[model samples]
Target: MTEPTSRSAPADQTQKEGSVVMQLMKHGKEVGVPSNELSSANAAADQKGQPTLEIRKDYMYRSTGRPEKTDMIKSLLTDQDASRNCELYLSASSNCSAVESSEDSEEDMYRDAEEIEREKILLCETSSSEHKVSVAPETDIMEYCRKEWRGSTPVAIRMRKGYEAVAQKFASIRRVRGDNYCALRATLFQALSQTTQLPSWLRSEDFTMLPENLLSKYDWIKQWQLKHRLGRKMGEISDEIKEYLMLLRKKWKNISEIKGPVEKQEACDKLFKNEEEEYSLYEALKFLMLNTAIELYNDDKDGRRVPVFSWLLFARDTSSNPCQLMHNHLNHIGHSGGLEQVEMFLLAYALQHTIQVYRLYKYSTDEFITLYPNDPEEDWPVVTLITEDDRHYNIPVRMCQETVL
Candidate 1:
C-alpha cells in the first residue's frame, strides 16, 4: 500500500461530491421545491451509482416540483437575456406559424366578401313593419347617395304626410256644428254692447235665436274662415255620431219648451238639481227681460208709450200700489238722471196723506190741551178734523166719532 494512499483523500473527494449535491439541492429549493425531497432524490441517485450527469435532469427537477412548469418554460423562453438563448428562436417559430394560418384563411377572403354583399341585398329587399331599417356598418358615401337617389321615402316624412291629411279631414268636420261662427258673432255683440255703454236696447233681443246663416255672413266669419277652414272630413263622423246626437238633442230640448211653470220647474230640477246651476237660467232670463224693457222704453216710433205700470199690474193681479210699481220700473231703467225725478215725485205723493193726518192730529190735541188742562174734575171736549176740498175742518161736537189714525 503506497502508505495506504492516505484515507483522507477518498473522504475529501466524497465531501466535495456531497457539497456539489447540496448546491444543486439549494438551487432547486430557491426555484420553489421542498429541500428534503430534493436532497433525498439526489442521495438515492448517488447510492445507485448513477452517473451524476444523468442525475442533473434539470427538466425532471423542474417538472417534478412545479405545477406551472409550462408557464415557467414560456417565461424563460421569452426572456431576452436567458441563459438558454432560445427566446429569439421560439419567437421566430411562433411568428411563422401565425403567418401560415393567416395565409390559409386569406384564401376565402373573396368568398366572404361575396357572402356579405348578398346579405346586405337580402336585408335591403325585405320590407317589415316590425323591424326598422338601419344603415349598414361602414357604409360608403356613394352607397348613401345611391339610396337617396332611389327615392326610398323616409319613415318620418311618410308619417308626417299621413298626419297632415288626417288633420285636414278633422278640420272639415268641425264646420258642420255651426257653433264656431255663431259663437264669434255672439262674442262680438257682447263686446260691443259692453264697451259702448249703450243701453241693452242696442243689443239683439233673444240673440241666441239669430240664424246661423246670418251669423256666418258676418265680417268676423270671413276673418275666421281665412284663418282656419271649418268642417271635418268624411267617414270620421260615424265614430263621433253618438256624442253629436246627444248634444243635438240637448240643444233641441233647450230651445223647445212646451210646458207650464210647474212642469218647467220640475224639468229644470231634474236637469239641474243644484242651486248653482239655476244661476245660469236666472242670468239668461234677466238678460232677455232687460233687453226687452230697454227696447220698449227707448222706442220713439210709437206714439203711445208702453206703460210698464200696466205690464206690472197685469203680472200681479192683486191690488198693488201704482206709485211703488212705477218707482220699481224706473229703477229697472237704471238711468240715474231720470230716476231722480221719478223718485222725488213718488216720495212727495207717499208723504202727502201722512203729513195731513199728522197736522190734523196736532191741531186737535193743542186745542183740547188749552181748553181742559187745569180742571181735573171736568171732562175735555173732543175735537175731530175732516178732509173736505183738500182742507182740514174741525168739528165742535164729538158725538160717537171715530178717528182713523
Candidate 2:
C-alpha cells in the first residue's frame, strides 16, 4: 500500500480522538460490549477520511473536551445553520450527569432515613408497655380493711364485725398457745377436768372454773360439740352453711360428667359468681375437686380399682349445680392422664359426699343431664377412663419415663 505511513494526524486531533475512543472503550467494558470491536470501528472511520473531518461514534461531544474536532466534523457534515445543533449534545450530557448525581444523593438519603426509622421501631418493640409500681404492705392491709367494710348490707356489716372480733380472739389465743401443741393440749385437758365433776385434790383444782379468758380456746370445740349434739339431736342446721356445703358437694360430683355448653356455663356461673368481690363457693368447690382428682389419679396408679359410677356420682352433685367444676375437672383429666386417675380416686368419696349433700338439699340429676347432653349408648353414668392400654393415648411414655429415671 504506498509504504503504510506511520505519520498519522495533528497531535491535538489525534489526542482528542484517541481520548474519546478510549472513553468509549471504557464505557463498552462497563456495558459488556466487545472493546476490540469498538476499537476496530473507530480505526476504520479515521482511515476513510481527513482526520479532522471524520465523524466517529455519535455520542462523542464538545463538553467531553473534543470541542474543536467535534465542531469541525459538524461543519463538514451539515450547512452553516446546523452549527446550533452542536450545543444540543453538550447540553444533554450536562443534564444527564446532573440527573445521575441527584438520583445517587436521593438514594443515599432514603437509605439513611430507613435505617433510622427501623432502629426507632426496634426500640419501641423492645420497651415495656406498662410502668412498674411498688405496693407497700401497709397500703395493701388498709385496702383490704376498706374493702371488707365498704359495703353496708346487713350480712356484709355483720361479717366485718365478726371478722374483727375473730381477729382479736385469734391474737389473744396466739399469745396463750405460744405455737406449742403440748401446752395447748395441757390447757385443754385442765379445762376439761374443771368443766366436769371431780375430787378437788385428785381432779387438780388448780384447773378450776376453766378460765373465762380461755373461752377463745374452746370456741372450735364448743362449736363442734354443739353441732354434733344439738344439730343431730334437734335436727337444726344453719340454712346458709348447709347451702354452701351442698353447692360444694354438687360441684365435686358433676365436673367430669358436665358434657355440654349450657351445663358448663351454669357451672362456671356458680363457681365464679361475685368472684370479683369475694371468695366464691364455686372457687372452693373447684379447689376441692382439683385436689380430689389429683389424689384419685395417683391412687389409680397404685392398682386401686375405683368404680367409674362413683366418679359420675361425685361429678353429678346438683346442690348449687357444680357443672362448671365438673367441666374443669374433666378438662384437666382429659389432657393429663395423671389428673384423670386422680379424678377416678375421688369417685367413691365424691359419691358418698354427693349422697350426703343430696340428703341435705334436694336437686334433680335429670335436670343436670338435660343441661349436659348425654353421650350416645346411654353411658350417662360412666366416666370415660383413658388408661395406658388405650391405643389412642399417644402421649410419649418414654419422655415421662426418662424424667422419672
Candidate 3:
C-alpha cells in the first residue's frame, strides 16, 4: 500500500501473466518444455520427459462451452454499468473481472489485503542424504511466536525499538514438516482447515468415491471456485475434465466406500497411478489458484483498486514462476522439489491490510527483522516465524539449484 516497499517484486518483473489457462495451453504443444520457463519451476516437468497433461488447443476451449469474444460484447446490455460481483460472474462470463472486485467486507478485507498480487514459483531440493539444512531444530521456528523481540542485545533491542508493536500481535508460529513443500503445504493446510464448513448444497450430492478425509478438500475447492467466479472464467469444462473430475470424485469417495484404510489407500493409488493425470491435476490446481489471484487483483469499485504486489513471491530472487513451483516432480539427480520450503504461503494468503513475518536468524549479526508490520486497527492479524537456518534455505541459493524443465 505504501508503494509496496522493497518486499514487492520490481515493476518489470511484475508484468501480468495473461490467462493462466492460455499460458499453460502453450505447454500443451509437442515441442516439450522450454528453458526460460524451466528457470522458475522447481521440478514440475518430470525426468521421463512428460508433462501432466499434454494439453491441446481443442481441449483448451470448446465452441459450445461458452460464447466467443464478439458474442460476449454484443450480449452486454449496458456499457455504462461496470459493477459486477461474485454472483454476477458465476452467472455470466467476464474477462474484465480478472483484476477487479468490489469493496471488501471484514472477511474479504483480510483476504484482499494479502492479495498482494504475485506469482513467482520456486521449489526446494529434496535429497536422500537426510542431512538437515540448518542448525536450528524444526521446533525452534515456534520460539518467536510468543517471544517478543526484546532484550538488551543489539538485534533484539533494534527489533523492540523498531517493531515491538506489530511483532507482539502475532498469534503463534505454525510449524509444518520440512520433508517437502513446507510453504505450499502449510498454507494450503490452513486454508483448507479454515474452509472446513460444508455448504448444505454440497452435502446433497453423492461423492461416495472420495476418501472421507478428502471430501472437504474437494468441496473447499468447489466453494472457492464459485465464490471467486473462477468457474465462470474457465467457461464450461470439457467432458474430459468433467470425466477426470468425476474419476477423482469416485477415487476420493472410495476412501469411505472401501472398508479398510489400507484397502482405501490402495484404491486411491490405483486412481492416481497415472503420471499424466497426476501432472494434469497439479497444473489444473495451479491454474485455479492463478485464476483466484487474477480475479482478486482486478477487483475494483468507483475506479479505485487495491493492487497486489506480485503474483509470484520469493525470499531473495524476484523472478520465480509459480506455475512451475506448484507441480511435484523429481529430477535426474533424484531430488524432488515437491517437498521443499518454497514460499508457498503466497498461494493461500492474498492482498490484505498487512501481514508481517519475523525470522529468528541465529546465524546472522542483524538476526531479527520485521518482515511484515501494520497497525492492528488498519491491518488484519499478522506475522510468521522462522529460524536463521530456515531463512538461509528460503534465500537465493535454491533459485540457482539444478533442476530444469
Best by lDDT: 3
lDDT over C-alpha atoms for residue 353 of model 1: 12
Clashing pairs in 1: 169-233, 171-231, 172-231, 172-232, 173-231, 173-232, 174-231, 174-232, 175-231
TM-score of each: 0.16, 0.16, 0.29
What is the Å distance of residue 108 in model 1 from its true position? 99
For each candidate, what is the lDDT?
A: 0.24, 0.26, 0.27
Q: Model 2 residue 123 lDDT? A: 42
lDDT order, best first, reads 3, 2, 1
Q: What TM-score does candidate 2 get on C-alpha atoms?
A: 0.16
Stretches of candidate 2 exceeding 4 Å from the true structure? 1-143, 169-313, 317-327, 330-405
lDDT tens string, model 1, 203-270? 22323432233233332212110111137453322223223223323432452343454444344334
Two-way lDDT contest, 1 vs 2, winner: 2
Q: Whole-model lDDT for model 3 versus the true structure?
A: 0.27
RMSD in Å for all candidates: 57.7, 44.2, 20.0
For residue 334, model 1's alpha carbon misses the true position, in angstroms, by: 16
Runs in model 1 deviating more than 4 A are 1-206, 209-266, 300-302, 308-405
